[model samples]
Target: MGAARSRILLDNDTGIDDALALAYLAACEHVEIVAVTSSPGNVDAEAVAANNRALLALCGQPAVPVLIGARQPLRVALVTTPETHGPQGVGYATLPAPPGPGEESLDAIDFWIEAARAEPGELIALFTAPLTNFALALRREPRLPWLLGKVVIMGGAFYHQGNTTPTAEWNTHVDPHAAAEVFAAYSAAAEAGLDTEKLPILCSLDTTERFEMRPELLTDLAAAAHCTAPEIVSEADPSGTRSGASNPLVRYLSDALRFYFEFHRDYDQGYIAHVHDFFAAGIAAGTMEHRTRAATVAVETESPLLIGTTVADFRGLWGKAANAHVVSWNDPDAGFAELVDRLGALARQLDPMG
Candidate 1:
């Protein structure tokens, strides 16, 4: 009949950008989201699950299963960011309650193992959160590295100053031990003769921070929303007192980004926000223009001063073979344009009433 849609299993922590990434994927026509697994990072696991369910419902994909994952990092105490993502992890955006509680039959780590076993070389695992679930799965099933089609992760701060610590990004910083375990496991698997093509691809802050969502992009997106879903704009404000944005997807994103924008302005001295996880999802979908360099990456697990630091050995300092494809840079103009176009297209596809 038609070309098969790419199968993906998304593991996220349901932060604001993660929620945006989920909505972006739900609107994509060429990818089929098999399931979503949540973990604790920006928010707790239970709240993350709830956010995923609520966001999916708002996007009209209420049927997509949301599975709760680890309540905390593998070995470290729980660290959350209510200050960054607001109390609910979605800023001021208020979504309807999910239709029901998420699937409770299996743990998220188990689900990852079973899905990989069932699909073998056909499942694309996208990790946009801490790696506790992945580390646990790999511990339980060592063959997991060779069984998946590909692994794309969004973490680390290579070549750029860290967001959480002087040398660590938030995701990796939240669970450095788990992150170390995952990178080392995949490297060991490759050395043991598993195909090299299945190695993990990392989208780090070095590239993601280059592409910021400026006010003009948001304005254009709102305009596109107005053209696509006029009714949503009307409903948002019946009296027309507010800036009309008809697309629920755009409205949701715009609302959630208000807080993020403020954070960037204060922290980074910029008025725009970086959509970090969205770039990772784009890399997984092969829709972003990027430049990569193969490197031997190791996460610092023991040093307190450098905990969660992604030590990318581009100079062969460690005498280890390269195990990860690191995205050194991305074309900011092309990336921003593609992201805006994709978002607008999704808004139109999901809400064609305007």
Candidate 2:
């Protein structure tokens, strides 16, 4: 294959893992992250933007466009669980205080409008947080349908059990309205000849959970944080209890994520906390491949606890038709290794004292 670095716009909520994914993307030689839009999920939107700035700084990348978006879910209140991620997002990384002034002041949708319009049909949008900003962007720019590229989203539990609720995943659960809209757009985009019709590429929780943070990866991460800030949370808690540690950023996000992670693990002992968004970045950056099968992936709009659940079935819907190719299974070990290798490569590129 030839070298094809994608022009990308990443939408995230600045969760700890999301921060990790950003660092990887900043250092990837094959991807050009054009812009970053912040949303509400694991952390608040403004904090999300600040966190993005921090990751960019870590990678020695100068001021990239960090646009703020969707402080709360569309038509719903913001729900952030600190017991999983910690108090402040970076496992409670006490940020040095945000920059004096924020960059380009466009809202999430408008920023998307500008970015996509500037590079019509050539941008790879990576969504790691809730779909709130994306849905709003679609509503704001009807022509977004025409100015699009391949979309790689990191949310939903297609075949695997849910991580946030009985049948819902966090990114989708936070905003089912947006999730529904995004899925509809995905289907419509496929139908409109923008991207592939059977193009439901999912980097589900299954693939993310398989990534065991090998000692080398963790050490690199921890060492990089020495001058920046200490990590409050040590490692994944097997018993599902929030950690009682004291790092600036790590504690906040880890505590919040632990609450969510514990609930999922308690319900299904087979579950491991997935770093969720890493796969989206990898797929968007062209470091991975996903095999798709024709399927009907739907998000539940009215379930009580299972509201944002994504269900994938082998049998296609008769009327709706199997117009999507959702991922049912992934090679866990291989995928995990690739993720680690990429992260390691990024660390070497960004770590200053190395």
Candidate 3:
């Protein structure tokens, strides 16, 4: 893991998976979380920012700034999936409110634009939310692609079934217009001959869905953390049940993921959770293996039926240059194992008595 050196500027909706991603990043030693920005997706921007602050504090990174961005998606009524991620977007887990003054007043767009410019090519932008904030920032700073070191996005289902609509991913569907704007801006940068290495790594649902989390991972993590009692999360557990693990981190994760498992099972997808954002965060931190193909990616915004559907042309079928390196391969089992090793170690470090 290159967490000792990765400088990450994260933007997320702070849902269940987003919380897990943020917690993982915080656990890594010396990982410079430049800042975290809230965006609207699984929940509203306010709740998202709150979640970020709370998660950071729980992970012992309380000083990390949590900025509030756009409260609504660009050009659409905000649609939140409370049923999917619970009321506050963190499943049934109850996190304490942040303790101190945070980045509530600071504009997330301006903060990112300034950060990217002040430290040109030094910050990695990990966007795991709707593209509304990034799109709005692009309107102010059109050269975002040139300023940031690299980008990793967790949205869009290129070749897989959509979790929101029949043809649309949840993040993209929340704001199709913004997703289109982001891809178009990246395409422009690619046309201007930006380094292919710096091209955005799109961690679309096609690969992320493969990162399905199962109950055994909780057991492994608990064992690694040397918990006193066995930790179990099963499909047979009653709905709305919470974790009573001795370790705080283990308890938080177990309770959070229990809701996700139920969500998937309710949709007939079994008791596993598709932790999409965790893979993106891991890729940005250089802690996970992944493969991507250069593609000219675009979003369908105007069509009523296919809106928010991300279309990728890999064979130069479209005359445009490649804007994103769409992730094509990843190992879910390996990723889960790494999560247990890294996060479980961090948990033990945080609570030695456990």
Candidate 4:
């Protein structure tokens, strides 16, 4: 018998990496993306909604609903990453406008609550951006932690340098208050008898940085794209001068990576880019193996210098029970191999041969 497919609700900011993560999820055969909720982070809420719609259409899943969420952080001024993800949040990837407007009946928080209530213990909530929507949802439905089947988040940093500040990652740093609220609410939910085994799972910078998108992976993906969808490659090539060097997916990723790779190269002293959210999606879809450590994690929201820092209590310093599972380690070689395999699968799914 085939493995069971997981129902996932993806919350994203729809930047370059988020777009790649969306492609990964859409291509994954064992994942049923129940809904997509967008919030302001890498870009504004409107851009995120547009990106979600366009990416879904490009991936042949235009039927999926795209709901707009929070326009700003819960308790701070809006911070955006135009330098990294380009002004439109998707770099040079030109996508068509959404066919229709967003769902009018329910907003992002409402959509999350309704979906979770409908599915009970069968919905996986995947967050790849700031936690504003999640914090708001938890506030409206305090029992959400108990209702969700699982929660996979791509944020935080442990034993690694921060991407936004000296002490914090971008997603958490953008909305430390929301991150704090989320962690605290999950802890409270556990105290109220929620299952401990299904506590929030975190794929932090500590683990994701290990799996970088090197040139070889890009070459392999481009080759796969050519084999599965030569028409897409032709369209992407446009001038027909590149000799079928790229496909739609490869072109989109390459265009985005032009900026992303430069950012890492100049700032982090690396030529490769890491799709951090892809790891979170993989964890949610059960496509990758990882090693985790049970730790009591608390987001720092008070200190100006340390705000959004993930304070992991590896030692029993506060006498608090572990509230989250931190993915501290993973084999990069194997993980990237699986990722390439999945990307190839997605290419075929998006554009099947005649």
Candidate 5:
């Protein structure tokens, strides 16, 4: 076998987009998923853990460990997006039940602590959920920032229209206290003269929204996967329609994304999906092209009306060092094309006879 290009520790709440992100990562041959820790957002932590394991198994990467993490937000009662991500977070896709909790089960915080300490500066961390689990990990080991090689986060609105609230994004709004703690930890590290190069690359909604998933991409993906029949997701279809795709992977993705498409249509965004996490996943794999701007980032945790709002000081107006490299822009056309090619390669591999 070939050497791994990047080692990643994925922390996500496996909503529809999160499932797509995990599938994209699992499909990539050069990427090594060290572990996955469930965080509450799209669903409860236990359900998120199940989604991660089920998707990984579907993608033929069942060996990757799936750990359980914080079930609720740090300072608030948990809120899940069943309306947006369906009841169990995978939309209409019904995956094989994950094996019962046993040796496969592990604590997220403990894994983060042990893995980082064991191989300092080797693991690249990616957070596509609320920061609850990572913040708890930081509380246990304050030096996690220095121990990890790099970090990539997918949260916050960053001046974009909010998907959850008037001023907040879904992930941050789910657990603003944990989000606050994460940025504060980085700010403290910068003040202490630590190597700030390890500051996370944040994929806020500003640019992520540009990577929309229209129904045509699914048709293209099906063609790439060499499916015997066309896979189509239509907005006019009766609600809760399921895919009858010939390819297993295509069928799974089609079912999941159909729910996402309907959700977006209901919100008046047409039948397109803002696959925010998938873009972040591409950045983590070093495959998708993108640009960034250094900024001092912070999330609001106090104001009742502004809780979970993220503000970025782009010009050092905060008189503090930059805490993150916020993504400024991304090539959505290239992004969509890359996604189709990569995911199609995996689907074709999984069911070659098609």
Candidate 6:
């Protein structure tokens, strides 16, 4: 059977892996990227929106709308991590100045509202950042639960170690209050018989870590087949090599990724970075295995070192919250093979000479 097509609204913080996953999603055929929203986490919301627009243009999908989301959590000071993401937001990538007035006026929550309401009950809200915007969206318009098909989030730590803090994942810790609200809202929606059973949220530790980017997908990238770093993809071709030259943006993504790779390599011994965001994208693209389980997840906002912690248990404790579907585990080899196959197909299709 062909992959199932689904309407998607992507909310991201636009970090290293985010850029890669966005490129992957833009190349997918089964997923229609209706709107792209930005949230504050790895970088500021405004910076993310600009980067998102640039990436969208590069992927040959510039028409897709880019909306700016929350600058900070609803009731907290914005916390940003430059150690992971460079001070400029995207590592090794230098972005141009803001195109226009920027995304402040519109906000991420409002963007979610319009897009969610526009496709009422038919949209898949794929989140790969702090739940600030998601929580704020729910608060602004509590009715959105009735309008979404699912919410596949790439955040939180269930059993694996957290990336940012001791216990909480980057996204959830940035805004646990918002995360709590989002989780609560979804659970309420499901209990009310809104067909929310189809709503599955793939968190970071449990699902995202399962999918990694294979070296094969890096072949075209290493060859500098198309646009290189700084030079936008819409402006150049990736097929021909210009004698020791590469696209600026491609180079930036590569260098940043390589640095990131080295960081992991030192610890894990030849560890390649996993496409955490891509896991959510894969589910949206209808390629990941997911099932509805009677599981309960909770957000720990009070713990000194364990804030935004996600605890999963089938015992149904902590009020049996609403979590979409967690890809508890996956076959890394098979999953990466499929991911590379799809990526190769997309690269050829996007390349002018292929």
Candidate number of the best TM-score = 3
Q: Candidate 4: lDDT of 276? A: 90
Model 2 worst lDDT window (10 residues): 244-253
Q: How many backbone clashes does candidate 6 have?
A: 22
Superposition TM-score, candidate 6 onto the true structure: 0.84
| lDDT per residue (tens digit) for residues 1-354 in model 2 | 224878888999888678767866875778788888888888788778877776675566646788887778986778985756655676534445445565737776888888789888888888889989889898888567567676777877765677788677888889988988866776676556754532546666656555433323343333443424433333354553443322222333344444434544554643335566766777778776666666556788886767888876557544554435555455545555665455545554544343
Model 6 C-alpha RMSD vs. true structure (Å) is 5.4
Model 1, residue 238: C-alpha shift (Å): 22
RMSD of 1: 3.9
Superposition error at 296 for model 4 (Å) = 1.0
The true-versus-predicted C-alpha distance at residue 102 of model 6, in Å, is 6.5
Clashes of 5: 0
Clashing pairs in 3: none
lDDT of 1: 0.81
State the lDDT of candidate 4 residue by residue for 269-332, as single tens digits.
5767787988888888877778788888899888888988998887868887778899987777
CA-RMSD of model 5: 1.9
- Tell me, what's the RMSD of every candidate? 3.9, 4.8, 1.1, 3.7, 1.9, 5.4
TM-score per prediction, in order, is 0.92, 0.80, 0.98, 0.92, 0.97, 0.84
Clashes of each: 1, 35, 0, 0, 0, 22
Regions of model 3 farther than 4 Å from truth: 1-4
lDDT tens digits, residues 87-129, model 6? 6566556545435544446656777788778777788888888
Residues 1-354, model 1: lDDT tens digits: 122467889999888889888887776678788888988998898888889988888777888888875788988898998777878887656678876666744588888899899989999899999998899889999999888998999999888999999889999999999999999997898789877688898989998787687656767776665564332222123221233366777777867776676667667557677889888887777677777888889999888899999989888888887788898878778767776777788777778884
Deviation of model 4 at 301, angstroms:
1.1
Please list the C-alpha lDDT of all candidates, in the order they appear. Answer: 0.81, 0.66, 0.90, 0.81, 0.90, 0.68
Which model, 1 or 6, shows the larger lDDT?
1
Candidate 4 error regions (>4 Å): 1-3, 227-246
